[model samples]
Target: MAKRRALISVSDKTGIVDFARELAGLGVEIISTGGTASLLEREGIPVIGISDVTGFPEILDGRVKTLHPAVHSGLLAIRDNEEHRRTMEELGLGYIDFVIVNLYPFQQTIAKPDVGYEEAVENIDIGGPTMLRSAAKNHAFVTVVVDAADYAGVLQEIKEGGDTTLETRKRLAAKVFRHTAAYDALIGDYLSQQAGEQLPERFTVTYEKIQDLRYGENPHQRAAFYRKPLAGKGDLTTAEQLHGKELSYNNINDANAALAIVKEFDEPAVVAVKHMNPCGVGIGTTVAEAYRKAYESDPTSIFGGIVAANRTVDAETAGMLSELFLEIVLAPDFTPEALGILTRKKNIRLLKLGDWSRAAERKPEWLVTSVAGGMLVQESDVLSVEASELKVVTDRQPTEEELKQLLFGWKVVKHVKSNAIVLAKDNMTIGVGAGQMNRVGAARIAVEQAGDKARGAVLASDAFFPMGDTVELAAKAGITAIIQPGGSIRDEESIAAANANGIAMVFTGVRHFKH
Candidate 1:
């Protein structure tokens, strides 16, 4: 067999120097371009610049360096064809056996606090995707790598067998295609943001294989975790787990939702989530008390819901948690003894997250949602309208106790489906109406569930009332205060009814429609 040629280009220099040095020891000639070539050359390894081999000067502001036929033709040619070799020999093309490349850091660059639009557009790579696609298209003849983590395995296979195995080549080729696809999507998303339109068809989702799960939403369905690859700089996927079982599909969903809900509470808080909705939420003087109140909100729902704590979980609270059944618990820190008790249930997913003490300090711009063949994107509901901002159309202003319960109900209702209603007293939810056909129906169900407890309690509605019917119903159920997003055309009528009935009402000026 003749000596194989490997081309390596990467923006992330992590382990590239060492990987290139080891490839040199394997008698493989290294070809790279631009910064990669310059860096490899600095390490005393003889490297061939892509421009030198292409016989074309790097043009178009360095975008045309590796897009020439010399690079792609060498990568895509069928190695087993006699005519292919004959033509390659005439053109003086290299038999590029391996291509190691990762694309530009467009995600990281755009996430910077001061990144300009032109700067983001410039970070987009043209030649990198060309090389990657060409290499993947000819996976039968070459090996391709898109991840630095695969470097050791690739080197081990090459050293032990003098070539990457056929299976490794196929897998690496798959990674190359996924990499290019995700790259294109990132660019599309960026372009759409500049256009000020939420376009789902503009971007496509492609993910590399992270790990296969034991099962999917159910025990029978197949599942795997294909990370967004690039989410927030230090988002949930970047979370470090000090102790826990491998996260299941439901665990990850519930945990993420639980954290999002608990992050809303500015004070020390704990929330219990089930099926991506908060079954219980509580804010208290201590994390243990918060957890207790949240748990007592509905012990039945808390049985297997994901528990999220904004503060640390200590041994005392950890011991308390051990007494119940829970699918997962996410907190900032856990004392050594707390972890010891928590780990007794091997299947319980335990996670330690960042202290959300700074959650009140940050404000994000947009929230993204995906649909089948469509997407809906909007500004985040981080807007909290102060009481002073509330227009007091009602004759009665809510007392402090009623205000607390109203806000509590408001939080729980936001997580419920549209046309949703929740009734609450104290720190616990007394009743919940979810996925109802109409807002009035949702309200009735909630009041009915609370029964005698409905009197003097507060109610929350996810959307505006079209008329005074909902307020009339809440008055019939003896609700002392009501909270809903006020945007209806009949907002005056509802306000008049609330005032006439002496019901305390507050407008959030923000709607939480969870359809």
Candidate 2:
């Protein structure tokens, strides 16, 4: 039998030298290209240059090196076929038993600050993917390796026997295809961004696995956490877990909701989230005051909820937080005394933010939700409304104090699920009704929750009131001011109800519908 031959070409040189050395010791001839060949020869590992095997010098700046029939036929030739052997003899092609390759650093190149288009374009590997696919397609007869972590396993198998097992080759080939697909997707997404295309013909995104959760939303379901390859600073994935048990699926989801709500306020803020909905939100001069107000918003719902604070946690705030049975507490930082107090609870998760300002300022370009067959993608809702942009639509205009409360309520209501109603007073949410089927039902729930607190509080609706019943309900609850998008055809009825009840109403002209 002819001596076995292996081709080794890679952009990531991790563990390649040792693997190649072992292959040479096992009597497998090593063929390499470009920098990989030079590095191996320098490391005292015997190497046969790819040009020496193909009899063709690498041309076009090394882009056209491995695109020849010599490389493909060597990788693709059927070992057990007589016709394939005859063709290989006719064309002087040698059978390649192993193909080791990893693609160029396109992802790292694009992630650099102010990277030029030419540099990014140059990093896209052409011959690498072609060689990988050809070798992987013949995995029944060829062994392919794309990840450096798999190098040890392949080497061990080769040491035990003469070549890798068929099962190992099949698994490695699947990994190679997945790696190449993700690489191409990243390049596609970068090019689409450069072309300023909002929605491309074929949209693709890639994420790297962060962890495998114990379970999903339920105990029986399976789940894993993944983050974008190029996540920005201060994202939820950037949070450092200082204490507590492994994060559950619900914990991460609820904590993310709380973080999104806390970022809406410039002042010291606290948001308590339960089951992906905000139970209470408060902004105050100090974090302690914010936590107190948030706790007072809904003491019952905040028992096992996740709390996110915009400012650092001091001893005083930590003392108050320790009084409750909370699931998670997230803040920009924590004092030593505060950590000492919170660490006593073994089940509570403590996460420190990377950068508070960056978290507040950064906005996601797209929000995706997966459905049964496909996903729905839309631009993230980052709208900020000022007092000057509001149009008073009632005879009794809102006073200055009412305007501040109205704007605060508007920001809080935007994060709530659709059919949402928020009653806020003094920059604190007094009552919140989310995900109701009808606007009036949502309003009634908020009013009932607030009770006497609803008298002077301002009401903010996610969408325009379809009828005057919601206005009447608010009037009965003594809601002083109302803020809504005001695009309903029955706008006159609502305005009349507001005017007759001496309630102030304003139209933002922008609806915030979060479903």
Candidate 3:
């Protein structure tokens, strides 16, 4: 029988020397290239260089080494075909039974803060990916390994038997294609950004799986958590879970919503989110007070919600949190006492997100959503209207206190699902109506939730009221002032309604529609 041959080439030399040595001991001829050959030779493992195999020296700074027919024909030729076997013997070409390769660190190089374009471009491996693709394409005969983590398993299988099984080869081939695809995607995305293309002609993103959840939003569904390659600081995807069981899909979703809302405030703030909608939001003198106010805003709705705080959690706040049946609690930091108190509830997931305050200033580059058969991509909704940008379109102007509450309500309403209405007083959201089908329906819900509190509070609508009915509802509920984006054609009718009911209304000239 002909001697089995294996080609090994890698930028990451982890476990390569030992793997090659084991293969050599098993009567397998080892062929390698460049740094891999040097490392193997130093470790007392005999290696046949690419130059020896192809009878041609590496040219173009080693870029043209593995592109030769000698290398690819060995990896791609069919073993079952008599003609191919005859041709291989005629050309003195040997069959490559295995190919172990890993691409250069292009993603890692580009991640550096001071990486130059030339350095990044040079790191994109051409020959390595070509060899891998060739080997993977013929995986019915050849075994290919891309990840260093698979080295031990491949060697173990080879030791147990003379060669790997077809099942193992097929699985390894699938991984190789996925690895190369991600490599190509990284290169394309980086170059597009370097060329100042905000929205690429083709939108492509790669993510690494963080964890597989027990189930999705429901038990019958499957779900996993994936994060972008270069996630920025203060991103929820990068948050550390300090204690408790693994996070469920719903917990992560609601925690993200709560975190986004809490990040909007610079002061000590707490936000409770249920089903991706803010059930309560409050800013207070201390983190404990903020949690108390937020919890009291709608205690029933916040029963099983996720809570996020912009400030570091103290013992007092943790004590208050322990009283509730919450899913998750996220904060920038937690005092030793706070952690001790919260950990008592073993099922509650505690996440300590360092420097979460910075999230308010960090804008995501893109927002992606999945639909029936495709994806929708757009710039993130990072725009927020300042207090100075508010236009008093009503006959009566909002009082200074009313303006403060209106701004607070505006911030909270932006995070609520549409059609959304938020009623706030003293920088605390007393009521929030989210995901209603109509503006009037949302307004009525908020008014009913606030009850007597709506009399002196301000109302913030995510979008303009379609008609005066919503304005009339708020007026009847005794809401003192109203703030909205105000782009509807019937803005005059709503303004007249506010004026007639002695309610001051301000138009922000900006809309925040969250679906």
Clashes of each: 0, 0, 0
Using Cα atoms with residue i matched to residue i, what is each candidate's TM-score against the true structure? Answer: 0.83, 0.96, 0.95
Model 2 residue 81 lDDT? 93
**Model 2 ranges off by over 4 Å:** 356-364
Residue 248 displacement in candidate 1 (angstroms): 1.7
Candidate 3: global Cα-lDDT?
A: 0.91
Tens digit per residue, CA lDDT, model 2, 1-515: 89988899999999999999999999999999999999999999999999988899999888888888899999998888999999999988898888999989999999998999999999999999999999999999999999999999999998898788999999999999988999999999998889998888777988888999999999999999998888776678888999999999999999988998899888899999999889999889999999999999999999999999989999999999999899999999899999999999998999998665644364657778999999988988888789999999999989999999999999899999989999999889999999999999999999999999999999999999999999999999999999999999999999999999999999999999988
CA lDDT, every prediction?
Answer: 0.82, 0.92, 0.91
Ranking by TM-score: 2, 3, 1
Q: Write the per-residue lDDT of candidate 3 for residues 1-515, one digit (tens) a residue.
A: 99999999999888888888889999999999998999999899989999999999999888788899999999999999999999999999988999999989998999898999999999999999999999999999999999989988998998898789999999999999989998998999999989988887798888888999999989999999998888766778999899988999998888888888888888899999999999889999999999988998999999988999988999999999999899999999899999999999989999988894354455657879999999999887767777889999999999999999999999899999999999999779998999999988998888899989888899999999888999888888889899999999999999999999999999999889999
Model 1 clashing residue pairs (backbone): none
Query: How much does each candidate deviate from the true structure in C-alpha RMSD?
Result: 3.9, 1.8, 1.8
Better of 1 and 3 by lDDT: 3
**Residue 168 displacement (Å), model 1:** 4.4
